[model samples]
Target chain A: MSGRPIFTRPARLAAIVPYVWMLLLFLVPFGFVLKISLSQSALSQPPYLPTFAIAMDDAAWRAALGLLSVDSFRLLLTDNLYVLSYLRSLVVALVSTALLLAIGYPIAYGMARLPLRWQPVAMMLVIVPFWTSFLIRIYAWITILQHDGLLNQVLLALRIVAEPVVWLSTDSAMYLGMIYSYLPFMILPLYATLSKMDPALLEAANDLGASPRRAFWSITLPLSLPGVAAGWLLCFIPITGEFVIPDLLAGSESSMIGQTLWLEFFTNKDWPVASAIAIVLLLVLLTPLAIYNRLQRRQLEAR
Target chain B: MRANRLSPFNIICLTLGAAFLYLPIVILVIYSFNASRLVTVWGGWSLRWYQDLFNDSAMLAAAWMSLRVGVASATLATLLGTLAAVALARGEGFRGRGAFSGMLYAPLVMPEVITGLSLLLLFVAVNAERGFWTVTAAHTTLTMCFVAVAVQSRLSALDRGLEEAAMDLGCTPTRAFIAVTLTLIWPAIAAGWMLAFTLSLDDVVIASFATGPGSATLPIRIYSEVRLGVKPQINAVCTLIIALITVLIVTASLVSKLSRARGESAAPL
Candidate 1:
């Protein structure tokens, strides 16, 4: 105990390495983003004015600052479409997280209850699909959900419907695609938490004359809260910024935050406004992001 | 009790869930072998698309470019990530450690579109041309965080006593780490490297913003081609990518299983 140097000098120096890299690469780039957001939009070579033109006199500096208006932000606030798109993305993300948890919890519970020898292979099966190219998976969905696609062919053959329904480019299709793509993220964590749980607690609950369902509700669900939180955060964060799936699967109905941001930057070339939307998006997500970091930090320190 | 057995309710849920997860990709793999030019039709099986893919020069270049980026970035990311993990797992008191850790972990789940846009803007502001190096930089930046997570978990689980004993004996801190700690965490580090490689190989959104003309990565090429229609050529490419990733994952799992089976008798988890 006496030999332990908790705050060693070598370790402190080692800590500086990542900080310096983050300061230069991570923080400075974010500062650049803030500066660009404050800049004015224009139709020029760079499509935004006064970019790193630091040679201005004091008088020119004021003029440049004045020109670097908050109009992009103002426009974002005033526009109903922008506001609704943000809300829509949030709604979709939350709903998708819910769907993932509902479907994933049972599978995770089942896998966790299986014999120990089969657990590793079962976990691998869940993960291999997740590790595959995300784009290819989305393509697979498109093929399945298209009007004359696989789903339609099967339904027609089975006489489930008289004709092939228009399943692609609809809200239902978008939701299905989102859940399919993100289900693994939900299952992995839930399984991790559930599989490590003590079986005796449930046995005790049952031995105390509680029904099996009551024991599950009283013991199992509450116990898996950590997994549920982790799984929810994992699915929610990325879905808010999801673009490719919605763009591919939905018609003009779904206006996700990522889709709006992409259109502003790529199609409209509105760099200032696009940056503003991104900055606003970050601010909105700041709470969940902080909570996520805190949760991770607590986990790290708990060990 | 009967509850320990697989109930019919759970059996149904497990089967449906498994089918939902696997059926799409399974069908895609099956369709990749179809002789029909159209994705919808099921003609006799043939390897014509695979042969056609081999003869396509543009795709060949994109594949080569993606390979180069994956290898280079995964190497650098593994090095830097291991260092960062060392700092986190072994480092003592340091100011702003919480915030520093946040920076490392935040990007793992950050929206790819936002990251792509922000990094592209940074490049434009600095007047750096977007191309291979930029894509590599973006990818390395992203993958390093994942690598750090893997290595950090392993390092944290390591026994402090072994390293302390080495330090007690005449070994310096660096030498102690190299001799005692590195050997234990080496497999985890290698797995993280492979994970980073697959991540970079499959990335498209970030590479889209970061790439310039004649430097399209394989995913970017595939994205453009798949946008107009799902061509059979892309099917061939996607099948190959799946095969490669599947092989890597199976091999990694097998290694872990073998190591665990042997180590279980020797040490407790």
Candidate 2:
């Protein structure tokens, strides 16, 4: 007998190692966040009350559960600051994602149509900026969008404006940063799908006398929907909770939920409130993420 | 053929998009060498900011810590992530496979603030010290998911026949994987490691949440300084990072291409 098992001992151990590690570090932390979210903010070492002990007996466990309250979430509902910031974040995410789609589609199409040798080069160009420091990229904008910065200098020299434009600390500058930072995320996925299209399909359309625009609408756009969906989720989900761009480039008055959570946790030391914001943000993101997962699984199965 | 050919419209889109993507960082690089104190004045090409960057002790210390964290986390993440990828790609009908993959992909879409907050809370609950180790653990947990995805794609695309042949030749399962599968997927694993390292280096929000008072990374330091305003020294640091990454990537591609050419020529012999 060969005596070789289907699931070898080492294979089982290897799989279990990562599974257990993820269970401990990745999955368990959310439970802690959830528990803290239901607790009261207080003046303490850990900054929350009614911390749960796994060693507690059933009665003590029940008692701890009873002490947990939803006041933090209630505050999220009642506080104009929390509610408005959530709405603002949603609006910003939606607008920015739509802008990404509009701007990314043409560029990705152009990339896909490039010669085989140039395609990889174009892809690398998109990725190089992505590899650069995210903080530095955002900071780079502050230099250009400042009132007397290079953008204004160029605008003034061209007589596009009578004076230097007040670009920094404006929503316009904030959106510019958002679009610039997230554009690669949008383009990469779109290019993946676009580049895989059969040129014969477009050739057939051209032979049938369909206009390029007509072919794009009837064929290209329909085929690229999956990429559009992928890109949409990629950009929209994180942008909803974006802390950096809005914090750095947006006006002080435009407080998104991410900044709110940051201030709550760091400045005010309100861990409960911050946890509530995180939980709610996760809840808001779950639907799209589920859809994305389903789509990915289907693609995997098809493969 | 029409679709393959570049039209004027496509050319314009490519040009404009490239400009939009690249212009800001290029301008920032140019400004890094400005001799004048004012950032916009274009003070005639000096390395004053780069010189000051060398002398800033806090920034230097933070950079050192970041390098340490990047190496540690990237190594850990690569090992775990490669294992996870192999298991998912090859181990069919494993229990909790659905849940395993869910855990793998969830972090990719999960917001950084949520991840950071949750991890910090967990550390606090466990009474673990919130310092360099905690930050490394957090970065490893997050970046490993990216590594897993990258490696998994490569693994799934690999021909399993090679490993099966090795096994048929009396190699053990582990030896077959080592000689065939691991060798084939080495590039993906290396790419995954680099991706994880850069991600650990670039992360600010997660590090900020996970970090203690004295364990700030380079991005965290740059972030705090940036909040105060754009400084020439920070620009110089950013320029150096960009240049370093560009050089590494170019060299990697050149080496890969040369090796590919050599392999093609050798195969005919």
Could you say which candidate leads in lDDT?
A: 2
Could you give the TM-score of chain B for each candidate, in order? 0.92, 0.94
Q: Return the lDDT, model 1, position A275.
A: 88
Tell how far residue A165 is off in model 2, in angstroms: 1.1
**Where is the poorest 10-residue window by lDDT in model 2 chain B?**
B260-269
What residue pairs clash in candidate 2, if any at all?
none
- Superposition error at A176 for model 1 (Å): 1.8
lDDT of 1 by residue, A141-246 (tens): 8877777789999999999999989988888888888998898889988998888788888779888999989988988899999888888887888899888888
Candidate 2 wrong stretches, greater than 4 Å: A1-13, A54-63, B1-3, B258-269
Calculate candidate 1's fnat.
Answer: 0.51
Evaluated at residue B73, the lDDT of candidate 1 is: 89
Per-residue lDDT of candidate 1, residues B121-186 (tens digit):
878888888788888888888898888999999988887887888788878887888887886788
Clashing pairs in 1: none
